[model samples]
Target: MFRQATRLLVRPISRTGSRRFSTDLPVAETADESFVEAWKKVIPNIEPPKTPLSFMQPRPATPSSIPSKLTVNFVLPYASELSKKEVDMIIIPATTGQMGVLPGHVATIAELKPGVISVHEGNEVTKYFISSGFAFIHANSIADVIAIEAVPLDQIDSSSVQKGLAEFTQKVSSASTDLEKAEAQIGMDVHSALNSALTG
Candidate 1:
């Protein structure tokens, strides 16, 4: 049988003298020293939360730096007092309803229905009528409003609008499919409603 024993030697030592302890067998002190060294190195790299209770700090959100000015292109004969440089807010007819877009707005794409398009340019407001089209605005404080058919208020004729309404009503009544019927009905109803509302 193997037995391990420890020995102790005592002597009168001075107050500043070093005391030593010895073991019967070899023991590793390097492991403890290495572990402590490793922990010290890892502590600085670990991140601490900004808050007192949190474990990690949150990253800051990226800022959107948008430029000034807006460019609008309309396929129809629409005119506006707003210049490409002075536009701030845009009010246009969307498939759902009227959409009001302002500066620093989030990016979006929308389908425009037939209705009056009002754009807010600084202190002035401009209005135009648009047919089926799409518009795109960016978070960068700029918008490129292009449409398929655009008609200025002064350029829009009552006779042509009335004719479109009558034809649309007929199409809506006899539409073969749900999709066709809905589209025709929406267009007709929107145009009719706009004529009444804007002309009033």
Candidate 2:
């Protein structure tokens, strides 16, 4: 069966004498023109259509071309309005990860961790330590940071943070139940973040 299959695969194809593969055929007379000649005789020259004057005019500027400022509304609970102004950029410490938002950033809602939020404008940068909250970045260059508690970098006292860290650490170590340990750990984390923010 293998020999028979090989013989059939290697078989030479027979060609009929009527079939022609070369371009050496005799041309028809001028009166009996071929299809190509008939097409060339009728079509003649081909030219592209001229563009209109309106199409040549310059296009208008796009929305992205004109630089826009990001409007930031950094608010806190207890009627504390930290900032309600426009900034160039905002670096948020989101729970998933850190995110930098600009004017044309895509819309998103991120849960902020107990970390610092940096607001940049021109050559100056302002930073604030936030407890926790949500940040909403809109498509129209508007960012709203609603935090539970927010304090300016300069306003936070290093000594107070160190003391709180020590107390929280003690509480975490002495925690008896799981719930108590979790609460104490959360407090310690916040204090640790506060200490870092102050020193960093």
Candidate 3:
């Protein structure tokens, strides 16, 4: 009697649920080696198919002690803001609230709102106003922050921000269609956050 070599693994998909993996359903870590080997033996001409695991970097194991620093990679569509920068802590504008992330933080994916992301390193703090994005915090003290539009707070023009805020406020009240109203509201939110980041 032969037994299956595959072992099952379960992981959380949401706040209160989990999904199970089985032999019938495959994952990157459980790619069918037997099938690949058979294919190689039969044809020996083509390369074996690559799994998602092969394309992804292996996750580092969690350390025993809380790390002193967190590795951050802040990225934008046009440029990479911070590449593997080690920082003491970072404050992100999450939808729920401003969340301060530190080393050894539990793995989470935070939906960022229009606000400022403050990267704190010792006594130096760098601030940037982001339109919106997501932050992925991993268990290995690494955080990947992705934003669509971000600019240094110092580089922003206060007068321009105020002017835009006024325009958006007028647009909000004058908007006739639902789409226009939503766009105006979004513009207002972003400007409000920008104003707060500058003033606060």
TM-score on alpha carbons, each prediction: 0.51, 0.65, 0.75
Q: How much RMSD separates candidate 2 from the native structure?
A: 21.8
Tens digits of per-residue lDDT for model 1, 22-69: 211111233233333444454545432222212323322324564455
Q: Put down candidate 3 lDDT per residue, 37-138, tens digits, no spaces.
A: 545665567675554445565556678888899999999999999999999999999999999999999988999999999999999999999999999998
- The 10 consecutive residues of candidate 1 with the worst lDDT sum are 1-10
* Model 2 C-alpha lDDT per residue in residues 26-95, reported as the tens digit of each score: 3112212333343444444632222232134332223454246888988877855545688889999999
**Model 1 superposed RMSD (Cα):** 22.1
Clashes of 2: 0
In model 2, which regions exceed 4 Å deviation?
1-67, 80-84
- Scored by CA lDDT, what does every candidate get? 0.60, 0.73, 0.82
Which pairs of residues collide in candidate 3? none
Error of 3 at 90 (Å): 0.3
**Once model 1 is optimally superposed onto the true structure by TM-score, how far is the C-alpha of residue 115 displaced, in angstroms?**
1.4
Candidate 1 positional error at 174, Å: 5.5
Per-residue lDDT of 189 in model 2: 93
Instruction: Flag clash pairs in model 1.
Output: 66-140, 76-150, 78-152
